[model samples]
Every structure is written in C-alpha cells, then in structure tokens.
Target: MKRIAILNCLKANDVCAGAACLKAFNSRSRHFEQYGAEPIELVAMGRCNGCEVGIDEGFQEKLDRIIEEGAEVCHLGVCTIKSETRQECKTITEAANYLETHGVQIVRGTH
Candidate 1:
C-alpha cells in the first residue's frame, strides 16, 4: 500500500472543512487516480499548530506519528499553499522541508 496523509493549514482550519480534500481522494480524482496500481492508504490527516512565535513543539510529535504510520506521501491542503501571510508561507516551507528530509514525498495540494 502507498501510505498517504493530508496536512492542513492551522490558520484556515476554521474555514476549511476539508470536505474537498476528502471528496477528491474518496472519489479518486485525477490527483490520485494514477497513483500506480497499489491501493493508497490514508494514514493521517492533521493541521499545523499555527504560525505564532514559532512552530508548536507538538508539531514534531504529529509528524512523527505520520512517519511512524509509514506515510510515504503528504498532500498539503491548498490553504497551506494559498496562505496570505508570510509567516504561514515560512511555516509551510519549514514543515515541507522537514518532511522531505525525513523521506516523505510532499504533494503541494490536496484537493
């Protein structure tokens, strides 16, 4: 199985219901339709802690859980990519970099 995950933006957590992402994957939209013949397993779905003074300490814990779950792909929600603030951008970049270093493929958008 190709383990996957969805990472959401904390700032837009209230606004984004995550329906689109789920719908896209559940329906096997183009974004995921060609993920080889192997079944894709959604192992994690979570949001960033928030772009504050710095990333939350628990952020590492969350990522650890995903990695432990054998997640090989992480689809970042559009909210994270379409963030309006620079802090959010930085947070996303940092998190993406971390995920990459840990061997997780980072898909820029989720639905």
Candidate 2:
C-alpha cells in the first residue's frame, strides 16, 4: 500500500478538524484523484511548527516520526497553501523542501 502523510497549517489547527482532507483522501477525489484504485494508507497527520517559531525548532522531530511511520508521500493541506502572507508561503516551501530532502514525495494540496 502507498503510505501518505498530511501536513496542515498550524493556524487552523484550533478551528479545523481536517474532515475535508480526510474525506478527499478516503474518496480518492480532489487532490487525491491520482491514487485511483491503489491501496493507500494515511500514516500521519501533522502541522507546521507555527509562524513564530517556524519549522526550525521542533519540526524535525515530527518529521522523524512521520518517516518512522513509513510515510512515502506527504500532502500539504489546503490550509497550508491558503497563505495570507509571503512568509507563510515561504514556510510552506521550506517544509516541502525538508520533506523532499528526507525522500518523501510532496503533493501540494489535500482537498
């Protein structure tokens, strides 16, 4: 089975339950359409380290856990890309780069 992880926006964590992203993945629709009939597993659901601290502080620990769980691909949730400022976008890019360096394929959107 294909192992997948989802990285969401930290700012939305309090208000969002991630139901939309999960629904899209489970139904193989929207951003998850490419999976089609393949057997896929949702291995991890994580968030950015927060705007103030960025991903530099403790993000690596979270990434390590995701990797340990066998996440082959990671999808950046919609909330992550709906950046209100350039800094947010840059942070998302940095997160994606970090994931790539660790050998995980990055998918830009979740739902």
Candidate 3:
C-alpha cells in the first residue's frame, strides 16, 4: 500500500471537516486519480501553523510524525492552494518544501 499524508490550511480547519478530500482519496478521484485502485494508506493529516506564522511553530514535530508514519507522499488540500493571502501561499510553499526535503513527494491538491 502507498502511504499518504494530507496537509490542510490551518484557518480552514475551523469550518472544514475534510470530507471532500477524504472522499476523493477514498474514491481515487480528482488529484488522487493517479493512484487508481491501488491500495492507499492515509498516514497523517495536519494543518499549517497559520498565515501569520507560516510553518514556523511546532511544524517540525508534525512533520516528524508524518515522516515517522512512513508517508511517501503528501497532498496539500485545496484550501492550501486557494489560500486567501500571500502569506498563506508562502506557508504552503514552505510546507511543501519541508516535506520534499524530507523525501516525501508533494501533490498540489487533494480534490
């Protein structure tokens, strides 16, 4: 099975329960279509620190957990890519870079 992780926008966490992302992953639709019917394991789900701080505070711990879980790939949720501010965009970039540096492939969107 392919291990996967999902990173969402911190601000959106309050209202978004991630149903869409999970549905897409479970059905192998949208950005997850590449996986086809291959077995997939969702190893982690986390959110960015927030636009003000980006990925600065406590993000390493989260990343460590994700890596420890054996996630080979990370999908940045749609909320992350559609961030409302430039700072949020930067946070998403930093999160993606951090994941990549640790050997996880980055997928721009989850659904």
Off by over 4 Å in 3: 83-88
RMSD per model, one decimal: 2.3, 1.8, 2.0
lDDT of 3 at 18: 91
Look at candidate 2 and give me any clashing residue pairs.
none
Per-residue lDDT over 1-111 for candidate 1, one digit per residue giving the tens place of the 0 to 100 score: 889998898877777887898888877784776675668889999998987834677988888888888899998887886545524377878888888899999988766
Error of 3 at 40 (Å): 0.4
Candidate 3 per-residue lDDT, tens place, 50-88, comes to 878766758867888888899999998878765455243
State the lDDT of candidate 2 residue by residue for 26-82, as single tens digits.
999998999989999999998988878777757878888888898999999878765
Identify the leading candidate in terms of lDDT: 2
The runs of at least 3 residues in candidate 2 whose Cα sits more than 4 Å from the true structure, single-residue gaps closed, are 83-88
lDDT of 2: 0.87
What is the Å distance of residue 98 in model 2 from its true position?
Answer: 1.1
True lDDT of residue 16, candidate 1:
81
Model 1 has a clash total of 0
Q: List the residue pairs that clash in candidate 1.
A: none
After aligning candidate 3 to the native by TM-score, how far in Å is the CA of 15 from where it should be? Answer: 1.5
Ranking by TM-score: 2, 3, 1
